[model samples]
Structures are given as C-alpha cells and as structure tokens.
Target: MEYEKQTEHKHHHVGYGTLILIWVALIALTSITVTIAGISLGSYTLFVALFIAAIKSSLVINIFMHIKFDEPIFKVFLIVSGFTLIVIFILTFSDFIYRG
Candidate 1:
C-alpha cells in the first residue's frame, strides 16, 4: 500500500511595512498614555491608561502573536480569559477600596 503525502497549506505572511505600522501605533499609544498620566484626570487616569494598554495588548496579540490567523477556539479562549482577568481586577480593586 502506498501512503499519500499531505500537502501543507501556506500561511499568510505579514509584511514588514505592516509590522512597522503596528510598531508605530504601539509607540504612539504608549506616548499618549504617558502624557495622559502627567495630566490630572482624577480617577479617569487609570481607566484611560488601562484602555490604551488593552488596545496595545490586543494589537500585539492579534498581529505579532498571529492570534488573528489562529482558530476560532483560540479567539474564544482569549475572550474568556480576558473577561476573567477583568473580573479579577474588579474584585481585587473593590476589595482594596472597601478595606481602606
């Protein structure tokens, strides 16, 4: 019996230009977060910083980590993990606030 060889599927390649663009955007977001930290936004400062950080993380994970091309289950797991993290952060913050 002869065994058939399976053909490999070609994966999508991200161009250097696309990577550079993402890097630039990440840098810009970092700068904006730092600038925001300097100004007095009261309690909103943490929220703004975390929001920017989340955007940066999403870009890094989806583009750099190739999560965008991954399977649907991976995306679903990512969402679930993110939701769990948010819940944990909220609980921790709430506990700290209540304790103080």
Candidate 2:
C-alpha cells in the first residue's frame, strides 16, 4: 500500500485561458515561420526555421501532450529520444557534407 501511494500519478489541470494563450502563440509562430520562408535569409534560413519549429514542438509536447506533469522517467525517455534523433540528424548531415 505504501508503494502504491508513492507511485501514484499526479493530476495536472490547465486553465482554459492558458490553453487559449498557447493556441494564439502557436498561430503567431506559424505566421512568423511562413513569413520567414518567403524572406530568403540564405543559409541561415533553414536554421531559423528549425529553431522556431523546435520551440513550437516543445510547447505542444509540454502543454498539449501533458508531458510536463508526467513522471520523471517519462521525461528521461523523452530526452533520450530527442538526443538520439539529434545524433541521427548530425550523422546524416555529416555524410551529406562529405559525399559532396
């Protein structure tokens, strides 16, 4: 019974106003991304777009997915997965760079 108590899940409640704000922020970021795409910043354009996309994804994961309120293990798993993806991206880009 004691172990059960320690392992119990938490209930995270988000307000309607907070959700609305997040939605607005997401819309604004999307608009900015679209506008940036048309501006043509040269090589820096891709990096800028990726940075903005990363922010948008994080907000979706933390708020919409409710990952922020979950257990620490889940958070660890997310970090590990993200790290793996980054490593894959790096390796792929490196190979592309060397092939040319």
Candidate 3:
C-alpha cells in the first residue's frame, strides 16, 4: 500500500524541465533584444522596446499564470481582458500623443 501511494505521488509530480528550458530561452532572447536596442534604430527604438516587453509579459502569463492550460472559457476571458486593456492603453496614449 505504501509503495502504491508513492508511485501515485510520483506520477502526479509535474516536471519543470520544459518550463526551465522555456524560461532560459526567453531570457536569452530578451538579452539579445536589449543588446539590439543599444544600437541606433532611428525612430523605432521605443516600438522595439515595447515589443520586447510584451513578449516577456506573454511568457510570464502563459507559464506562471497557467493560462495555456486553462479551460476555453478562461482563455476567452483572458483574451478579452487583454484586448480591453490594450484598447484602453491605446486610447489613453493617443490622447497624450495628439495633445499637440
């Protein structure tokens, strides 16, 4: 009985190997992006920085928040929330950007 319980627990233990690999890869990519940002990219530096930040945020949400494994309804809610946030952000930024 003890051996069977141990086996069940072992089977239920989720491995972090894949998550670690994803984290390391994302870290490397972020480092590369930061390095690239150091060079002169004309007027696109801000956009590039924002893009990198978005990628990093996506990795955190998918992994730490477990959004990737969530149900369809949860995914829909997440997607809607993300889009709503983006819309609000864009609206606010536009107001500031066009203040002139």
lDDT of 3: 0.76
- Range of the 10 consecutive residues with the lowest summed lDDT in candidate 2: 3-12
What tens-digit string does per-residue lDDT give for candidate 1 at 21-74?
Answer: 999999999999989989999888888999999999999999888778666788
lDDT of each: 0.85, 0.84, 0.76
In candidate 1, which residue pairs clash? none
In candidate 3, what are the lDDT values of residues 12-96, reduced to their tens digit?
Answer: 4435986787789789878978797889997678778878888877887776666665547877998899899889979998996
TM-score for each model: 0.83, 0.84, 0.68
Clashing pairs in 2: none
Residue 50 shift from truth in candidate 3, angstroms: 1.7
Off by over 4 Å in 3: 1-14
Error of 2 at 54 (Å): 0.5
Full candidate order by TM-score, most accurate first:
2, 1, 3
Looking at candidate 2, what is the lDDT of residue 42? Answer: 89
| Poorest stretch of ten by lDDT in candidate 3 | 6-15
Q: In angstroms, how far off is 59's CA in candidate 3?
A: 1.9
Q: What are the candidates' C-alpha RMSDs?
A: 4.4, 2.9, 5.8
